[model samples]
Target: MTTVTTRTVTYQADALTMVGHLALPAGSDRRPAVLIGPEGVGLSDVERRRAEALAELGYVALAFDLHGGRYLSDPEEMLARCMPLLADPDRMRGIGHAALDVLRAEPRADLDRVAAIGYGTGGAIALELGRDGVNLRAIGTVNGLTTGRPGEAARIRCPVWAGVGSEDPIMPPAQRQAFTAELQAAGVDWRLAVYGGALHAFHHPPVDHTALPGVGYHPRHAQRAWRDIVGLLAECLPVAE
Candidate 1:
């Protein structure tokens, strides 16, 4: 039988009090850990549930906050905060580090066996963490194909798996090309998965907030991406039997 326990964790990052969702597997033994980054809208039930799912699989999971315990439902509001944050790699790294510290402090977490997976703005933050040279077993992102400062990707010490909707306007072909080029030049072990006929934010469920053009959910692609992310972890940061 499998059991999962969960809790709320509050921490400080980027001058804001962040409330994160933490989930642990059934066993008392230290296990592989995963850091989950939410979309620009911030931490919501959507991400919280993902953490719980990971916990069911025997991985310590934490879904970190981005907007001080608030979920930004308005598109303009979300972009206002995320645009600047995304442009500043240091700030993104700071957010990632703060959450990582919280996860590492957990008794159930195996600090050395950890991965970072995120979506949208959260995905950008995860990539920033890897680029900042944080040791990670794997780095995965969905719909957040962001490029960092020149040569910064060389600091990444793990394999990277990025998924994007082929029709995503926000992360168009040029953007994806630039991001991939950086990883290629840095000689990082990176892979990209493009889901055909999908739009930006396709992995997310339909939001209750004001909708953004070119943003909608693709249920099939979403499940496929999740499988790929799980596959990445299994290959790089597998849980012990």
Candidate 2:
């Protein structure tokens, strides 16, 4: 892996001070950037490691935060915060844009060559950014197959890739169907990969806290999804050789 640097970046979104993890490649050249969003439980070392991993691959990565820098391990507490946040697209867009601004402001970031990738609630924010027409090079999400408002998917200008678990009750077959239908009708280039026998949040590593129902980790699928995301970035926003 290439040398990389890591830091904490504080920003405001949804009336909360978000403390995001920023990772930079070991170079002075302008580089493509990626935004990493965490699950509903909020930003943890899990996402921080992902950002550093992307940095090792020579891309600027910002693992944006939710819940003002707190990790809500309590399922009830997380839903209490995320349910309302999810219901308001504007709020989610606000958070996404706020993080995007942070990434773009970094001198090393190539503004035109940026992508958004996230998991769970964070995945939903990534999709929201695409729907908001943010000029992203590509969008990738795991367990974040959230359908957008009618006609909004048409605004997305880049290809979208999503991964889900076949047995995820939270995002069952019907939800996947509806999400794909919206994208298809909008004519957006999109693809979905369902990992058989996997559950929701399959991309996430095992957590120290109790997970919600239908939420569990699948190591094999997690590695596969990461590879697929790397492939997506390679095709759409490859780093300079």
Candidate 3:
């Protein structure tokens, strides 16, 4: 049986109190820490489950809330709250750094082998963190965009893996191609995995109609994505002897 423990950590961002949940493996000793950013809607049960699963894999996982304690089910409202952060990449980077600070404050987390994983808007934040040279061992994204300031490549210090749906309309083929070219030109160690027949938010097993437009949950893709994430983390953050 797998055991997981959850705790609340308080941190300040711009003088405002932000709360996050730290999930830990039952017997994990000095394991790497993973910071999990929720989707536009907020830290839902699904996101918590993802963090718990990571903890079960013997990593300290921190699921931070960028939206305080509020969550909206309506897609419009979710976008209203999330669009500002996406449009202003600098602000998004600040939020990612804030979450990293929270993770570093945890006693069980091994700050040296840190990684950030996100979905959609959250995914963009993960990419931003890596691009900004946050000392991340690795970064992973699920159906996230990669466009941002150009100079970020110089600051990137870790490998990145992005998973996207081949049919994802949000991140169209042309944009993906451009993004890939940019990463290549920047010489960032990165991998892009496109899942055919899968749509946006493929890793989210349940369709959130209120928060997503024309979304369909694919269990197989989600499972595969989960495995890929674990494998990537293992590769990037090898277990300490």
Candidate 4:
């Protein structure tokens, strides 16, 4: 059994109430915590499963919601709601910082080893947290984009691992190449895992991309992404229990 805590906290100065699921190791003290940002559909079963998996792995995982009860049932709807947020460039960063603050406030959380992982929009937020110097040990993103211009990469202060789909239409080859160049120029320690044939939301099980024929799921990529994320987290903050 896991000793996990659940609650809703206000982020962005009460502008948003984010429901968070925190999983802690049994009898563990000051364990590292990951501030997770859910995918476009917000906090769904996939994220919850990931949180529980992390908990089982002996790290405190905090899954925070950005979508607040409303979720998209289709790609069009998802894009309608997510596009503006991604375009803004600063909203995710602000929300990420706020969420990190909330996580740091937890008595059982080890603020020193704090890190972040975001999917899609959430991934961009994690990058922003690192870019803005949130004192993160490491960060990772799944199907996340880098919206800011080239020069902004210089601000990132933590190691980053980005899992991208080889055929993701939104984040195409050119964009990924540009993103990689920016990271290199900034001198940030980073790794890119390019999975073949996986679409944008590879890990989201309920996401059916039949409507968008080009989008399909690759189970291998999904499993590898999880492994890479778990490994990164464990390396940054080990299970001392």
Candidate 2 segments whose C-alpha is farther than 4 A from its true place: none
Task: Provide the overall lDDT of each model, using Cα atoms, as 2-decimal numbers.
Answer: 0.93, 0.94, 0.81, 0.76
| Higher-ranked by lDDT: 2 or 3 | 2
RMSD of each: 1.0, 0.9, 1.8, 2.3
Please provide, for model 4 over 23-88, each residue's C-alpha lDDT reduced to its tens digit, 9 standing for 90 to 100: 666674778888888886677767777877887776777777766654555778877777887876
lDDT of 1 by residue, 60-87 (tens): 9999999999999988998899999999
Model 3 gets an lDDT of: 0.81
Per-prediction TM-score to the true structure, in the order listed: 0.98, 0.98, 0.93, 0.90
Residue 140, model 1: lDDT of 98
**Model 2 accuracy (lDDT, Cα):** 0.94
Per-residue lDDT of candidate 2, residues 64-151 (tens digit): 9989999999988999999998888899999999999999999999999999999989999999999998999999989889999999
Instruction: Rate residue 218 of model 3 by lDDT.
Output: 77
Q: Which stretches of candidate 4 lie over 4 Å from their true place?
A: 1-14, 208-213
Which 10 successive residues of model 3 have the least lDDT summed? 207-216
Question: By TM-score, how accurate is candidate 1?
Answer: 0.98
> Residue-pair clashes per candidate, as listed?
0, 0, 0, 1
Model 1's lDDT to the true fold? 0.93
